[model samples]
Target: MIRTEFPEALYLLILIPFFFIIHYIYIKKKKARLNNLVDKELIKTIAPEISYGKLWTKFTLLNLAYAFIVIAISNPQIGTAIEKSERNGTDLMVCLDISNSMLAEDIKPNRISRAKQSLNNLINQLNNDRIGIIIFAGSAYVQLPITNDYSAAKTFIDVIDPSMISNQGTAIGEALEIANESFGEKNKNKSKSIILISDGEDNEEEAVSIAKK
Candidate 1:
């Protein structure tokens, strides 16, 4: 996983040999100047501090320092960013009717309770498919936007009550329209569907013909 951010900086390594060539020419010129000033045997006696071997050591250290700098400039990094893969499955929009009549005790504890239980079970059975919720009484509104997060969906569904909306009638057409819109335009070419749960008391706020589209 270790990688260099600037691999191009590694080209600086090529300058090391040229540094050595320049150091050699400079050392030769110093020696030639000393030969003109004094005999080769007496040069070391006159210049006690001037050691050609020490100059080579200094040049070698400088080159090492330059090499380390080049590597530092390359900026090596560890680990990599994880890429998220898209989940492939159908999209389902649940249009649940929460009108006052849905609270009738005809179906076990109440009709709305039973419908909510069914929604939770459906979510349990879902695999990678995305789901959304639209609660409709006299009007429709998105309770949950389309998402694959089943836990959040369950949290939203468990708290749904018939008393949430003041308007009390089954707006199935409005529910269907909102459900269609919630599917989104990008999913037009994909598999999309809606599951309507109601007590069969619809006032038809809008034409359901849009559902066919």
Candidate 2:
């Protein structure tokens, strides 16, 4: 669609007719003055370049140039057509337990390894959705901010281990709080969800209450 950046400049067009009127009046007064000073025939012979046709032509050209300048000042712009697509996915936060117990070999390769694999598979299935990761043991840290970059998410997930956190205990409450804070106020209107992947070893009973909040 075409638009004008300075539509107020178009108001200058109102002076176009006034330009011609003033030019016409000046020409008539010059002619009357010349007629009183000298004969019309002599005046014509003395100044052959001074013809009503030439003056009118110059006036028309000047008016056209003025109109174009005014239009140029308005700064016309054409915008590209944009196609809107609806986002049909919610914001998801995966809170993974990365305590020492996750290193236990109870689940195939290990709990932490299995959790990473599962999270990777889940990321691969996402479309138009933003996902973040919160890893916790004794404390919580944001492994990945909410984003659609599944590749970065997987990269972060692969590096998860027990040593990342200095403290050592399952603090699911802090993990949930961190996940809640990760969502931010920007996506408050969008649907949000948190998936906690743990061996149900939450030492903090406040995890459920924090989730409810």
Candidate 3:
């Protein structure tokens, strides 16, 4: 099975027949004009090497060469292909705090933006790992499900803000619980872990206890 990289190049083939017709008309006109202006015996004596059949053959060969050149430009290829992918990294859940405290001016350009930048950097270093995101304020929510697609994870992280959660407070315990549930209760993956980003302001005292479990 053969296929061309540029199927559009085939459109040039249509002009070949048009060119042949034009050449035929031009040759006929030139021959008639020569016969009218010059004697046949004198023409044969002056140009004894000229053969109409040979001239036509050369023109056909030129057009065939042009067609071959176009086909070469199209970069035709043969055979099929197969691809394989392997995953060998661990799973991780990132729990980000979007409470009002993250808006503190102590950090340069505020706290949330820096956190997101840090998260993006961390994501850049990961390979073949399934990562999920949990954004929490007064309540907890899963912003991205567990997946190996790091690009989509970075996109979702770029748009995270405190405004996403209407209830504006810290619920660290709930965030941890949501992450745990997302990891699933019977998952045997020992490499699974959670990354929590917060400003040390929280009402949930059981956050540490839940993380331990």
CA lDDT scores, all candidates in order: 0.89, 0.89, 0.89
lDDT of 2 by residue, 85-190 (tens): 8977889999998888888998889989998999999998998999999998888889899999989988998888888988888788999999998989985689
Q: Give one digit per residue, the lDDT tens place, for model 1 in 145-194.
A: 99999999999999999878889787899889999988877857778989
Best by TM-score: 2
Least accurate stretch of 10 residues (summed lDDT) in model 1?
201-210
TM-score of every candidate relative to the true structure: 0.57, 0.58, 0.57
Candidate 3 deviant stretches above 4 angstroms: 1-87, 185-187
Instruction: Give the total clashing residue pairs for model 2.
Output: 0
**Clashes in model 1: which pairs?**
none
Off by over 4 Å in 2: 1-85
* lDDT by residue for model 3 (18-113), tens: 999999998999889989999989999999887788889999999999999989888898977565867667889999999888989799788999
Clashing pairs in 3: none
* lDDT of prediction 2: 0.89
- Higher-ranked by TM-score: 1 or 2: 2
**Cα deviation of 208 in candidate 3 (Å)?**
1.7
